[model samples]
Target chain A: MSHANLLSPPSSIPPKTALSLSQKAPLILAASPTSSLPWPLSLLFSRESPESWTIHENLFLSSLRTGDDKSARLTLDRMTTRFGADNERIIALRGIYEEALANTPAELEKVFQGYEKILREDPTNLSIRKRRVAILKSLGRPADAITALTVLLENSPTDVEAWAELSELYASQGLWAQAIYSLEEVLLVMPNAWSAHAQLATLYYLSTPSNITTLSLSLRYFCRSIELNDTYLRGYYGLKLVSQKLLPLLSDSTSLKRNNDEEEAGPPPKLATVKKLEELATSKLAEIVRQYNAGKTGWTGLDEAEVIAAKALLDHGGIER
Target chain B: MAQPIVQTIHRDPALFWWILLPITVVMVLTGILRHYAMILLQTAPKKQALPQIRQQRSLVRGINLRTHAKVLPPASFQARKAYMVSAYQEGKFLADPESRGKPRPNPMSDPAAMEGMMGMMKGNMAMMVPQTLIMGWINAFFSGFVIMKLPFPLTPQFKSMLQSGVGTRDLDVRWVSSLSWYFLTLFGLQPVYNFILGSNNSATQSTQQMAANPGAGLMGPEQDPDKLFLSESENLEVLEYKWVLEGIEDRLVIKFGL
Candidate 1:
C-alpha cells in the first residue's frame, strides 16, 4: 500500500516534485490515448492499466498546480472526451481548472455561479458540493462556507476529508470546542492517523486555560502521536511544550493531591515521568533540527516551515521563560 | 484374497488426437470467451442521492465508532457511545425515517434490486450456457469411449464421476472417459489460460466465479437501516473500551530509553 502515489494528486506537492510531475504531462498526453473501447475491442489494442486514467487525472492537477495551463487544458480535454463533461468528478475537475485560470474576482464569481447551477440541477454531486464550499471560502464568506461544508458533512458523515476541512475551518474561526469536536470525529473514523492525533493535541494546547487537565490531555496525545510516528517534528515540538508545562505542575505535591480529589479524572503522570518525557522531546527536537539544518537526505522531506518553527521552539528555551 | 482384475481397454492411439485434445482445446477457448463476455457485460456503477448516501454513511460512521472506540478518550468515547445509542434507537439517521421498522419491499418490485438480480443471473447464464452445450456435445459425440488412464491411484468413489458414460460398474477407477476429461479440463485449465490471457483473466471458471460475487448488494435496497443501526448500537454498547493514549507517556519514555 506504500505506493508512490503516481495515480492520485498528492495533497501537498513540493515545488521540485510539482515541476517534475508537470513536466511529464506532455509525455502522458503524447502517449496518444490508451484504448477506451469496451473489453473485446480493448483487448485488440495495447492494454491500459487502470492506473492510466488516474495518472492522467493527477497529471492534469499537477499541470494546473505548476501553471502549465496549456498542458493542463490538453489533459483536461483528453479526460473530458474520455469521461465526458457531464461526469460528476470531471465536472469538479473542470471547475478547479476554471478557478485556477481565473484572473479577476468577476471570473471567480462566474465560476462560483457555475458550481451553483450544477448543484441546483443535481444537489447530490458531492464533488461539486465541495467545490462550492471552496468557492465560498475563497470569496471571503466564512459563514457561507461553513454552512456549505456542514451540509456536505450531513450528506456523508464518513467523509474524513470533509471532517478535517470542518475542523480546519472551526480552528481558523477560533471555535475551539467545535474545532476539537470535528477533529475528534476525524479521529473516530481514522483512529491511527498520527497527524490527526497531533492536530487535536495542538487544538487542546491552544484552547484557553491550559490547565493541568487539558495540558495532560495534550501531553498524552502528543505522546501517542510520536508513538505512532517518532519522526513527526510537530509531535516532538508539541510534546516538548506539554511535558515541560506539566513539570512544575507535577512537582507541586499539593497540585497532585488536588487532582487526586477529582476521582473521575485520571491521575497525572509522576514528576519524574514528565521530566524524562520532556528531556526526550527536547533531545529529539534538537536532533531533528540539527539533522534537518545540515540538509541531510532523510530529513529533506520535512516541511521547511515546520523545521524553522521547531528550531524557533528549541531556541526559545523552556516554559519557565 | 485374490488380486482384483484390472480392466484394461485397448483403444486406438488416434483417439488421443481426435477426442481428448479437441475437448480440452474447446474448453479452454470457451473459458476465454466467457471472460470477454463478462467484461462486456459489466455495468458502470450508478450514483445514489445525497440522502441515501447519508443513510449508508451514518451506519458506517457508527461502525467506525464501534471499531475504533478504544482510540478515543474515555469521556469522548462515552459521549459518542451515548449519542450513537440514542440516535440509532430513535432511528434519526434513516434516509427516509418513514421507512423505519417497515418490512423490506419485495426484491422483484424494486428496480434496483431487480437490476442486481439480473447481473447475478447474467453471470450464471454466462457460466451455465456454454457448459451445458459443451457437456451435451461431449456426451453425444464421445460418451461410449474410455479415453485416458491416470498415473496415480484413486479411490473407488471416483468411478461414478470419472467413468460416467461407460455403464460398467467394475472398470478400474484410474481409467477415465472422455466426459471426465472434459470435467477435468473445466476445473483445471486456469493455468493454461493464465499463460495465454494473463493471471487476472476471467478465463478460469472455478476461481473467477467465486470472485464475481460483486458486492453490488453492499447495504443494497433490501436491508432495513433501522435494524442495522440498532444492531450497531448494541455492538457499540457491548464494546470493551480501552483508550490508546492512557499511559502512552510511559510507553514512549521506555521506547526511547529516556
Candidate 2:
C-alpha cells in the first residue's frame, strides 16, 4: 500500500512523500505520550497505547530517511525515555540512528563495528543482524551482505522477510536461479501472498523467456496472483505481458497437434485459453487505468507510475500485437 | 400437577454483612493481585545460539511445508519433501549434532528444561498460593454458617458440600455453607477478573490448568528435537501433493468471463 493514500494529506507533494512525512514529525512528537516525568506523574498524564510507540518509531525512520536528523534524534530520545535504552527494538533504532548520521566510509565502518560488538554479545539479535546486512549493502559490499543474509537464513529458515530480501540481493547480482529459489521459499511459507506470486512471475519473466515451461509457469503464477487479489496492478500487468508474448507462438500451432508429452511437469496452457486470458487482461488493464485516473476516493492509492505505464502498454499494444 | 413445597432458611443478617460480602470482596481482590503478579513474574525469552535457532526453525519449516505444500507443483513438492526427509533423518539440523540417535536427557538434568519448568512453577505458585490462603482463611474464621441461598434448585448430591460444617443430613440442599461459597467464588470469579483486567488476563484458573500440562506448547523441551524432526519428516514424506494452480487457466477465463 502507498503511504500517500493513508496519509492523504491535501498538500500535493507527489514526488517527495518522505519530506512531507518528516515535516509531520514535530506535530507527532508534541502530541505523543510523555515519559519524561517520574513514574506516578507520567502514569497520571500518559495516554500511551501500543500504536503510539509504533507511530513514534515510524516517524523516527521517516525523519532519518529525509535527513531530518534533529527531529530523528528528538523522536529517538523520547522513545528511549519511554522504553529504556536497553530495550531490543530501541537498540536497533539506535543502530539505524548511528548509520544515518555517518557521513564517510570510515564512520560507517565504525558503526558497522558497533553492530558487530552488539552481535558478538548477543548473536541471536535478529534485528541487529539484519541491520548489519543493510549496512554492508550500503557500504558497497553486496557479496558480504549476501553471506550475512545466508547466515541469518541458516538460523531462521522460516523468516519470510529475510527470504524476500535474499531474493532481491540475488536478483541484483543476476543469480536468477537462487533468486527464484528464495522466492519459492517465501511462497512456501505464505501460500496466499499475492505480492510474492506477482514477484515470482516478474522474476520468471526476467530470468528466461525461451524456456517453454517458464512461459506457462509465469502465466499460471500471474493468474494465481490476480486470483488472490483481483485489483493487484502488477498481476494484471504481468498477465498482459505474458499473453502478449504467447500470442504469436500460439497462433501458428493450429496445424501441429497439442502435445500431451509432458507428464510430470504440468501441461502447457491451450492457445484458445491463452487468447481469452490476453483479452481479459487487456480489458482489465484498461478498466484499472480508467478507474485509477478518475481520482475516485478508493482508487487514489494506485501507483501513479504504474497506472501511467499500464496506459502506455495498452496504447502500444493496439499498434503492434 | 402437584406443586413441590419450597423450603426456606432464615439466617442472621449479620452473616451477609461480615462473612459473605468479605469473602466475595477478598476473592475479587486476590484475582486482581494474581493478574499483576503474573505480569511481574513473566521472563522475556532468552536468546539462543545460531545452531539452536536453526534446530528450532528447521522443524517449523518442515511442518509449514507439510501443511502448505498444496500450493506448490508436484515436482517441486517432491523435490522439497525428498530433501527435507533426508536432512531430518541425517540429523543435519540438530542443535547438538553429537547427540544424534541418543535418548533425550532427563528433564531434571537439563538446565533449559529446568528453566521452562521453573517458569511453569512460578505460575503455579501464583495460582496455588492465593488459593490455599483463601481456602484456609474461610475455613478458619467463617465455618459452620449458612450465609446465602441459591435462587435455583440443586440436586441432593450437593448436600455433602453445601452443608459440610453444619453436620445436618436433613437440611435442604438450597442452604449453602461458607466453605461451599468459597469454592463457588473460587471457580466462578473468572468473569469478574475478565472485567477488571482484560479478557486475556492470566488470573483465569482455566489457563493455569492448561499451562500445567506437560505438552502444552509446540516444541517445548518436553519433546526432543530429533524425534520431532523425524516424525515431521515422516509426515511430510507421506503428504499427498496437489497443486493450487491445477487448471487455473480455465478458472481465470471463467472468472473474467472471456
Candidate 3:
C-alpha cells in the first residue's frame, strides 16, 4: 500500500489500462484560457465559497440568462471600478443607470449628482442641466431651482415654463412687481398666456389700490380666462364675482325703460353681457351643487367664500349683490 | 465665451456647517422642519396661466380684462387668517390649479362642462373618500382638545378678540369645523400634480421656455389665442390652497386638474 510501490506497480500493471489512464488524465487536466481556474478543480470545489468577482460573475451570468439588462449592468458596475467608463460595458451600464434613475428617487438623486459632476467637467451639457432643474424643484429648492431654470431661459426667453416658474416664485413671495415683470416677459415671448393674463387680473385685483379699477382688471382677467377657456372654472368664478360687483350697474340698465334715458341709450350695452354672465353663474352654481351632491367633490381648497358663492347659485337664482 | 456659467462653486464644509446650523435653528424654532413639505407647498407660487386668456378677454369683453378671480373675503384680516388656518387643517382648501389659476374652467356655467366636471369631481372624491374621513376624525379630535384647553384667565384680551369677530359660540366652533373640512383638500394634491406639474410628457420641452427666460411675461409674442384657449390638456400648474382661496368667489367650485 506504500506510495512508491503503487507507482512502481503502474509499470507492472496492464499496458492497455495504463495507456487509457494516461490519455484520460491528460484530457481531463487540460487548462482553459477563459476559465479562472482549472475545470477539474472547479468541479471538485463547486461548493467552495466564492470571491466577490466570482459572485459578481455568477450574478452577471444569471442576469444575462434572464435577459435582465439592468441586473447585468449592475453586476458589471460592481465588477468594474468607476462604472467601466470609456469601456465597452459602459453603454450597457449607462442604459441601466438611466432606467434606474427614472424609477427610484434615490437612484435619480444619484444620477443627478453624477450628471452634475459631469456638468462641472462640461458646462454645455444642456440636457444634464435641464434634468438638474427638474430634480432640484422636485427636491424642493425653488430658489436654487429657479437659478438653474434661468440658465435655460436666458437663451430661450420664449420658454413659457421658465417664465411661469419665475412668476410663480415672485407671486409666492407676494412680490407683485417682480411677478408682473415676469408675466409681462412671458407675454412678450409667447403672447398667448391667457392663464397668465387671468393671473394678472387676479394680481391687479388683489394688489391694486382701488377696488373698482381692481374689480375691472379682475373682470378683465376673468373674461380673458373664460374667453380662453370657456370650459375652465376659474374664468367662470371670476365672471361670477365680477358680474356680482357690476350687478348694480347691469340691473339698473335693465330696469331703465325705453322711455328712460339710460334704456334709450341702445338697451344699455353692458347690461346684456352682465345678464348673460349672471345667468351663467346661476346655472353653473346649480350644476356644481348637483355634481357635488352626486359625489363630485369639486376640489379641496374652498374656504367659506367659495362655498357661499357656490351655495348662492344653488339656492338663489342670480340676484343682484 | 459664455463666461463660464458656473463661475465659482465653493463646496466648503466650513461654509456648509455655518449655513446648516442657522437653518437648523430657524427650522427648529418655527416647527418648519417637521412640516417643511407642507409649508413649501403652501408658500410656493402657483403656475402662471397660459396667454390665450388675455385675447379671450379682448374678444369677449372688447377689453382685455384679466380672467382671474380676486380671492378676497368679507372678513377682517384676523378672521380671514384664522379661517384659512382652520380651513387648511380641515382639508377643505381647494386651490387646485385647474380651477383656481388664470383661464380657469367654469364648471358651473355650461351644462356640458358641468356634467364633465361632475364626473371628474366624483372620481376625485371617490379616490379621497378614505383619506377625507380619516383625516376628518383626527383633526376633529385635536380641534376639540385645542378648544377645550382655552386658557381663559391667562389671556383675557386675546380671548375677547377671538370672541369679538362674531358670537362666542359660533366663533368657538368655527375652528374645529374648519379642521374637519381640511380633510377634503388633502387628497387633491395628487390630481393637481398629475394634471399640472406632470402636464408635459416631454420634460425637456415642457419648460424649455421657462428655463431659458426666467420672469418672461405671460403674453408671448405669438399670442395664439386659439392655442391659448381650448388648448390641449397637456401641462397644468400645481396651485396651493391658500393662494386659490385668497380670491375666491362667493361660491367655490374646485375642479381637480388630473
* Clash tally, candidates in order: 0, 0, 88
Provide C-alpha RMSD values for all models, in order.
Answer: 3.6, 3.9, 35.3
Model 1 TM? 0.88
Superposed by TM-score, candidate 1 places the C-alpha of residue B43 at a distance from the truth, in angstroms, of 3.0
Candidate 2 lDDT tens digits, A1-321:
346321333223454776767888878877768756786476446677767777777777778888899999999999997789888899999999999999999999999999999989888889999999999999999999999999999899999989999999999998987898899899989999999998988887778874446777888899999999999888988898988887676565653344553454487788899989888888889989998888777888887988988898899863232
- Model 3: DockQ score: 0.01
Give Cα-based local distance difference scores for all models.
Answer: 0.83, 0.83, 0.44
Candidate 1 retains true contacts at a fraction of: 0.81
lDDT of 1 at A300: 77
lDDT score, residue A104, model 2? 94
The two-chain DockQ for each candidate, comma-separated, is 0.69, 0.66, 0.01
- The chain B TM-scores of all candidates, as shown, are 0.85, 0.86, 0.18
Q: What range of 10 consecutive residues in model 2 chain B has the weakest lDDT sum?
A: B209-218
True contacts kept of each: 0.81, 0.90, 0.00
Interface RMSD for each candidate model? 1.4, 1.3, 16.0
What TM-score would each prediction reach against the true structure? 0.88, 0.88, 0.31
* lDDT string, candidate 3, B1-258, tens digits: 565242222334553344334333332322222122222322222222223332332222211112221222112222433432343333232223234334634446756445544544443443355445544554443232222223233334444333322234524322222232232234223343435334431112123233333433443332333333322111111212122222223212222111
